[model samples]
Target: MSADAFIAAGPRPPRAGAVATTATYAWRGLLKVRHVPEQLIDVTIGPILLLVMFTYVFGGAISGTTGDYLQFLLPGILVMGVLLTSVASGVILQADRAAGVVDRFRSLPSWRAAPLVGAVVADSVRYLATAAVILVTGLLLGFDAGGGLLGVLAAALLVTVFAFALSWLFTTLGLVVRGASAVQGIGMMAIFLLVFVSNVFVDPATLPAAVAAFVDVNPVSHLVTAVRTLLAGDPAGADVALALAEAAAVTAVFAPLTARLYGRP
Candidate 1:
């Protein structure tokens, strides 16, 4: 075909098979974790420390006993744990940018966003592992799901889905900021404010009126409330709906934005 013929043919869509390309990159991401085992420590240690300190030290003051507080705190802690882990996605992307990985992806004949999609897939695995650790730790600490097997499973699924959606937000930030330390610093500040001001450690009613109002509308609060309802075997009501809506909104906004900015990173 002549160049003129090709030009006349109009711009062809970048070859489709994004699934395989995404899987390949996802595998690369997993292997990175395997080679650098220390990367796993970030997700593991923080949750454990939070669980131990909260259940042992503050449990008595907050819930009258360790057992009671563990049950009450477990769901909230799970939400916080996954949110913290979400920061890693951004950091990883920042590293990839600095290492010229993004530039290589642009030169390759793969779908423009395949590597990012693959990263997102790998992140799902990471998020699932984090959720599993949280559940097992909660169980070992004497927290039981009154909502039974089905309830716990549903809650876990919901959280993993939300985590996937949330990852896109970080991915976009990585593309925009182009610095790991900057992403980490911003992520830490945002995560801390979101995690602390919500109903994770205490009842919202106990917060001062202005703070409580912010928590009431916070997306993390909705997620924690949904998880707690599921664990307690209570009706999820609209909490699950609200949480899903929040996740969908985030993914809808960030996923495409990240894809568009992937080449720039």
Candidate 2:
């Protein structure tokens, strides 16, 4: 047969399947976490060190009372913990790309969105683990969750959801970038800017007027405030809603973009 006839005679690749593909990718991601358990060390240790150092060293200087400081600082650390943990999503994506795991998956007859969606879902476990470490450490340091167990759990779930949304954004960045190292650098820079520029360690009003304005509007600040309010049993109607809205908006915007980019060479 002629080349054209041979091309026409062959079957076309299968259309993307949704449920099975997403589940398979999600399982693969969970397996990766199991194999690389050491990755949890940073998440666990970082919060502890930050809590110890800030409460002992800078706590008195900043808040004049370590007890009050722990309450204030722990919430910011919780936000930071989740944000920092989300950076791993980008690194893992870059690694998968470099190792050709993504290419191997792409060659299969599965859903195009599976790998992207599954990665985010799997990484959520890590977010939950990190948040737990932060909370336990905060409790040891005399931080109270006046909002009670349910509220604390709700705050944690909120952070996990936010982290999942962040994973989508970073995954897209990893797909667009050439190397894992470059992606790591970019991810670190973004996290630092988000954490440091917000009301993480100090009140935004204490910062310069321009800086304060930016921090007030920063989504991280709102998230931190919301978590703190929940923990303190304070009303968090608008702030919690805003944080959820932001996470939803981010996921809605980036999840499809990452899937499209992942499907491409």
Candidate 3:
């Protein structure tokens, strides 16, 4: 056939196998990570610096006891670390979409879920690293996990699941937003609002009545409290379950929204 005839023919159909798509996306994500080792540094170093600064600078004023303060602050830091790492999802998604990577993926004969699933799976490494650094920093600052090793592991897993859910929310935002800068600004604002308004630095009771009421119901506060209770060997009350449920609900709401947005022309 002439070159023109060959060019006129359509491209081969994409393979629709689930396992193949998963593996392809997984490997692609891993390869991207290998090329960008510096990404890991944020996960590791950010937590360390935050933990140290918070414990040393404000520990006395906050808790009147550094040890107890570390115990309380470390869990908040863990949640913050995971949330911080989640911002990268938006950043990366924005970059990919801007650079036409998502378009290229759409052109390919791959599973629709591959890109999203792969991104979340790969980003879990960052979440894990951040969690580990927070735990280590807590240890160095004399914070102990009163619930023992299993409790610590469970808390880490909880944080990871939360981070994964957050990734979906941010990914949708990134994909739908006009540009990366907008995504970053919005994500940062959201993070700051969630973290600061929660019972992260101060006891919610000490706040103004209106602020206290809002903070008491903030999901981030519930997550931080849950992590604190788990670390301090206290009861895992309804708060923890509530936080997990909220995170799950967020994932459910955003996952389909993202999928629909991503699938659109």
Candidate 4:
């Protein structure tokens, strides 16, 4: 009677598919922000502050007009905003590991990488939100997009892709790092170095030789340049290609590493 009754329950509902498990974990990631709304401050409010402060405080000094500076600054801000938000991938993952949440996921009869991949997928929404908020703010402050709607969408798509790749790198960091704060600190330092060393705030041509060399090679610079070119209606084929390649390389390298580390007992 017991065996027949169990068999009639339909093979334990055939375990969730990969997509279903991934989406469920992704939704779990979003629910964390719903309960703690302040988690979005870095992506939303932080970018707005940076946009306004940088555009107003140094805009006249650098570009001679806040209006003109806004044009140049907005795209860079998008890159910075989304990349910075990506750091949370590592921090939150580390927190989950410490809290035994990840261990629980490991015990489930689902894809092993779903929790990791889904966390990054959920953060992709935060990246898009950051891009949208910053873009809207830039427009309100008199920034214009010459590349039109299609270009803007392309730029947002590129930034999200790059941010997704970068999140994998941070997710690897989460797997290896002993504490959430350590992951956060390292991730922030890494991002700050990338942003500041790139051509985000200045032209590489104007910088000194050694610094300019580094800026010329910075992936963030390529991403910002691609975004700017898209916004300005210019041919960004080469820039976009290079930026995408960089993103692909990051994902190719760290995704496997994260999987390997996450699989460890």
All-Cα superposition RMSD per candidate = 4.9, 4.7, 3.3, 1.6
Q: Write model 1 residue lDDT over 80-166, tens digit each, in one string.
A: 888888888889998988998789888998888889988888988888888888888889888889999888888888888898899
Please give the lDDT score for candidate 1. 0.89
Structure candidate 4, residue pairs in collision:
none
All candidates: TM-score: 0.92, 0.91, 0.91, 0.96
Model 3, 204-253: lDDT tens digits are 88899989988988888988988888777778967679889989999999
The lDDT for every candidate, in the order shown, is 0.89, 0.88, 0.85, 0.92
| Candidate 4 weakest lDDT stretch, 10 residues | 6-15
Model 4 ranges with Cα > 4 A deviation: 1-11
Give lDDT for model 4.
0.92
Query: Which sections of candidate 1 miss by over 4 Å?
Result: 1-16
Tell me the tens digit of each residue's lDDT in model 2 across 1-265: 9999998899977665797778778899889768987877877898788778878888899999999888889989988988888988988998999999989888877766788888888889889988999898888878889999987998898889889988889999999898999988999899999999999999887899999999988989989999988888888899899999999999999988888888888
Question: Lowest-scoring 10 consecutive residues by lDDT in candidate 1?
Answer: 11-20
Better of 3 and 4 by TM-score: 4
Screening candidate 3 with a backbone cut-off below 3 angstroms (N, C-alpha, C), the clashing residue pairs are 14-109
Cα displacement (angstroms), candidate 1, residue 168, comes to 0.9
Report the Cα lDDT for residue 237, model 1: 72
Which numbered prediction scores highest in lDDT against the true structure? Answer: 4
